[model samples]
Target: MSNIIANQLDLFGAEEQSELFDEDAPTVYYHGDPDRVHARLHRLIAEARGAETLPWDQDSTRLYRKIVPQMVLWLPEEEAAQLRFEFEAELERMKAA
Candidate 1:
């Protein structure tokens, strides 16, 4: 039965998604409180407070995005997208100010 076949396909064990990743891959992440990044950015921008060279420069912006994701064997896409949007909104507020 199709139901039986589908049930059999479920490994349903620890790290069942391990096949999706290569452990040796290089990646970046923010292991600390994600909100801290936004707070820090706001502080930095506030300190600079209208400088020509803002703290969140091109490389810094890249690092922001760079800090957002990782080579984890698993992360729900919706969770990642939510995190991405949170950071993007933080940056947008910085830019708007």
Candidate 2:
């Protein structure tokens, strides 16, 4: 598991660049127990607002990757798509730059 996390961190790839978001959006509803996912999402959102890199490996990198996709299930479909698209686009831009 630790080895997997290290690999994920290596591929997380956004570490060297920061992407800026023009709007502040509340995290869509997440129906889960109070845990790291909730906190991490909030942190991610805040980072997005500040144009910072959103790190992976919360609890574990694999777990962090898993939680992000699951979170979309609780959001309105359009909002979920928009966020996903924007984030991916930024990551792509970062990778390119």
Candidate 3:
């Protein structure tokens, strides 16, 4: 009788033991190519500098405000700091206007 019940469970795809999560899984991060990132940051800086006022919509502005500084970290220390400073300065300039 027990063997028959086990066979029925097996036929129905029941598992006697299972884990809902795996703790040992490896985590992956994808940081884009440094030269590409640098170019993107430069373009963003140039666009902001060219604008007579804030260049992006409020949501886009907020997104850039939050991410640009963080993204700069993928660059060399000196370059990152320069880009971050330029981006922030432009934002402040636009806001003050």
lDDT by residue (tens digit), candidate 3, 25-88: 5676998788998999999999999997998999999999898888988899999999999999
Candidate 1 global CA lDDT score = 0.55
What's the distance in Å from true for residue 86, model 2?
0.9
Name the best candidate (by lDDT). Answer: 3
Taking all chains together, each candidate's TM-score versus the true structure is 0.35, 0.39, 0.72
**Candidate 2: which stretches are off by over 4 Å?**
1-66
Instruction: Find the candidate with the highest TM-score and give its number.
Output: 3
What is the descending TM-score order?
3, 2, 1
**Pairing residues by index, what is the TM-score of model 3?**
0.72
Residues 49-96, candidate 2: write the lDDT tens digits.
Answer: 455343443364446445566775566677667655655565445446
RMSD of 1: 14.1
**lDDT, residue 26, candidate 3:** 69
- Model 2 superposed RMSD (Cα): 21.1
Better model by TM-score: candidate 2 vs candidate 3:
3
Q: Which TM-score value belongs to model 2?
A: 0.39
- In candidate 1, stretches whose alpha carbon ends up further than 4 angstroms from where it belongs are 1-57, 66-74
